[model samples]
Target: MGFFKQVFKSVFKNIIDLSRPIFTFENNELKFKINSEYYYTFALNNYETKTRHDSYILEAYTINSDNLFVEYVHVDNDVTWNGLASSFFVNLFKEKLPINSMKIIEKKEFEHYEFITYKINDEFTLNFIYIYEINKDNFIIEKNAELYINLLQSFQKDYKYKFDKNQDLEFDINISIVKENALNGYFNLSN
Candidate 1:
């Protein structure tokens, strides 16, 4: 019975390992480690200060890749700073990222939270970073597009991205989350 149990566990572990993405590169290049954490509010109704923290870990490979795979390790780093949540999110634009380094692909709002997609280049290393906040209820999509276009123009002037004048810019970003109730769902029995 114990041998059977061990075999089952091994098979489960193998399955989980296979489910995770694998990384491989052909060129020898320096990889940059990206780490960022942000805590904001979701309760825009009552206007009370509430916060949730999110942390991301990103590994970059040489040569351009289509998507960025980041791991979420810590959640809710904003709980303690609840009293200042509103002001914190409102004053976010003070942060600015260097232009021409990355492209702004898309900005999305989910459940009253806003997220922006930025293009990543394998050649340009991380220099500066930006953190922008948006009010999902009031943030106009057209404004986001304007912001992206402006940023792209700056990038062209600043870095002169190596591309033909007619080439279209492209990149990918993804978001992953573990819900509050399913913190340990991976170990839970599924039906």
Candidate 2:
């Protein structure tokens, strides 16, 4: 349960608005929350990857209260949603690629879809996921993102960017939120 809870928190932190609608997966069924806009989704199938990276494929759907949209997604390699959106797939190599660089080897484009391939340079790798769309010629990001700092601890542990042991990893992204949205929606963790 803690694992799922972490996943939920990670998903939530990536979004800026808590008031908008959110959904989560449960017992193979999609549940929706109007106020908190929470959604829980677990990988139903392993996503296939061609690049030599420590990446995981996540396939989940946005469960809707209305039956107007597709209810089930078999295997979605990239993130998907029905709204004004934006996303990018970033590759993080275990060993910083000799000054950090990525090269796209392939790109497939269709009427309403696009997929790009990148050549990773190091051992351990992470696929930073972000996907977005343009609506009415005005592009707005439907999702906010927080990089997983835990994955970089081995690299930044003694290096020290800022903060202390007490600060949440999110502080790496936005330190101020540590006081406003403490783990429980308030500054209670310090106590």
TM per prediction: 0.19, 0.22
Q: Top lDDT: which candidate number?
A: 1
List candidate 2 stretches off by more than 4 Å: 1-43, 46-99, 122-191
What are the lDDT scores of the predictions, listed in order? 0.28, 0.27
Clashing residue pairs in candidate 1, if any? 53-76, 53-77, 100-155, 103-119
Poorest stretch of ten by lDDT in candidate 1: 135-144
> How many backbone clashes does every candidate have?
4, 18
- Tens-place lDDT per residue, model 1, 8-96, is 99998877655432212213321111112222111111111112232321221112222222222222323233223223322221222
Off by over 4 Å in 1: 1-3, 10-90, 95-105, 109-191
Local accuracy of candidate 2 as per-residue lDDT tens digits, 1-191? 99999999988876756433333344644233323343333232222211111111123222211111112222233422332222211211212224255554444332223333333343222222222222111111111111212212222344322321222211111111112222323111111
Q: Residue 73 of model 2: what lDDT?
A: 20
Worst 10 residues of 2 by lDDT: 136-145
Could you say which candidate leads in TM-score?
A: 2
